[model samples]
Target: MTRSVPQRRTLAAAAALAVACTAGAALSTAPAPPASAASPASPAPSASAAAGTASGYATENGGTTGGEGGATVRAGTGTQIHQALCSRAGTDTPLTIEVEGTVNHGNTSKVSGDSCDTAEDKIELKRISNVTIIGVGGGAVFDQVGIHIRESRNIIIRNVTVQNVRKSGSPTSNGGDAIGMEKDVSNVWVDHTTLRASGGEDEGYDGLFDLKNNTRYVTLSYSVLRDSGRGGLVGSSESDRSNGYLTYHHNLYRNIDSRTPLLRGGEAHMYNNHYVDVHESGINSRAGARAKVDSNYFQDSRNVLGTFYTNEAGYWEVSGNVYDNLTWSTPGDKTNPAGPDPESTTSVDIPYGYQLDDARCVPDIVSRTAGAGTGLGESDGRC
Candidate 1:
């Protein structure tokens, strides 16, 4: 379903919007409350009418209507969450789980059942469909626990925080990813969530958000991923090229070393994200990946876009992006950077409609609207 790329639109209108601070006034950029601050009131609206409604790829493939027209349950612990899924009427029975408070390994355990395939030490959503897990009340934090989605579809995770999960430490979960999806997973939307790790791979942390093994039709918006060596990757390796149709918008990536994220092979649309302090590399699009990189702000980063560590190249069509105080590495047999200055090597036609924020104000806009809580606040797109 490839459409011809449209002519590049001028950014004159976006540049003129530099003075519209009030447009972003509705967002909450507060640093306290840990980004996992309390949750929005519930008896939530259906998927089509919810606040901070999902856009982008998640809106395609028959659209992601997670747990719509279903019963709602409250789960405070991982065990309770597993129980909720186990109690479903059928494998595809729609259900919504409103999570509150802290969920740690101590309070989480495997629950065996007919409807789900559960595992120990992780919040496992596997071999099921039509479910929503949203933070509520005082907030939901998966402390040292990770969320794993496999062989699932039509799922949503919102307004929650998962941090400090590790692969080599005393406690490990989901191969150390804050959230991971694989094995034919599709139609998943993760929004207004915070995913962080204390350090890099050597320090036991893996990726913050990762997808692999044919996962598709996913969107990660208004989220925050930071302080990890690896932000995430689309496919596990250059040969693992079955994943595609991902949208990452209005998110913040701070102090990430690399792979923000490494796209092996796929079509991805990335816009309005703020990338700061990317020490090694960012947005490694390689192995024939095609990305529509638009209106993003990259600051204090190195090699923010390119094929790295391999000669197999990827292509991108970039526009309206602002690179501030960035450094470019010398091109080598194994490193091909997209800067000094970046230009389009290809074009991508997006199928959905989205509002673009001025690149100059992305940091401010993202800060205010991204991460958990803030009642799933979103930009009115005036900024």
Candidate 2:
């Protein structure tokens, strides 16, 4: 789906306040669990069952053996494992499975009639729930999405590396997103994974993780997102409406632009993360949304943070952030820089309890590019 840019600065002040409020709350509370645990009765399905009818099985000399209660099949030398896993019948029973090995044209030829390319297998999870697919150290690479979950819920994807996934071939909308969660999916966790867009120069897909519609209670943490043509992480709703609590913490975004906005109506929290070499603002909150961007380290970013083209009712709070080698728009330039910038925006009325005591905002490069001359400064705010 496409999004029309909203009016810049319309809700900037309110967004700043909301960010401050959320940051205060987050600072006062202890860290929550990395992933939400499901209820006892709703156990995950078996590895074999999760990957319907395991047809192929392959393992490296030292690869781990046995499925973890679900359809646990070590991908063998060919596409048999991928095909079997993708076509397996999904069970409502919650399951935890591990996928290992590398599958490309080198191993399996094609997945006969599957819509996905044959060299790589595309597994579709339809209406499955309470499933966790963890990757062992060996890694699983897919020419397309390693796994696609649609209309599913309460799922956990951890410690996996997905590469070479593209959305389209066009420069403007090419490079398929690595993980696409249709509108109906909810309560998912994606952590400790690396999503790289090797399709250089192509308009690689928007998000390493993409969610739409009523998808809720999602967490993305400790992952590395890089080389995305559009943005590192992207999320949206069909009609400026969203469902669930979204939390993104401790992830690294490198060489990316236009990070996802907290839009379509949901509660979002982004904290304790580091952003390096980003071309756009660290966080974008829009369309009558509420989000918190706090305690993040931003380095070499064009624009630091922004709330643009949002409805009047939209809210955001940004605080406890350290900006290094950050830049704002050129003087007389109304268009904000692409990444987070403390100087370009205003401070909200919310309580900013955490201050960068001379320790933060230590600039390695600050020069006059716009209206007043730019220079280095220290944080006077309380910690």
Every model's TM-score: 0.88, 0.62
Q: 379, model 2: CA deviation in Å?
A: 25
Off by over 4 Å in 1: 1-18, 21-52
Model 2 regions lying over 4 Å from their true place: 1-73, 76-90, 105-121, 170-175, 199-206, 232-240, 260-262, 309-314, 330-383
Each prediction's whole-model lDDT (CA): 0.84, 0.48
TM-score of 1: 0.88
Candidate with the greatest lDDT versus the true structure: 1
The local lDDT score (0 to 100) that residue 262 gets in candidate 1 is: 95
Deviation (Å) of 206 in candidate 2: 4.1
Candidate 1, after superposition: displacement of residue 137 in Å?
Answer: 1.4
lDDT of 1 by residue, 1-383 (tens): 21211122237644554565322221223321222222322333333323335678999998887887888888999999999999998879998888988999999988888898888889999999999888876788999999999999999899899999988878877588899998999999999899999999899999999999999999999999999999999998899999999999999999999998899999999999999999888999999999999989888788899888899999899997887777778787878888767889888888877767667768876877789765677665443
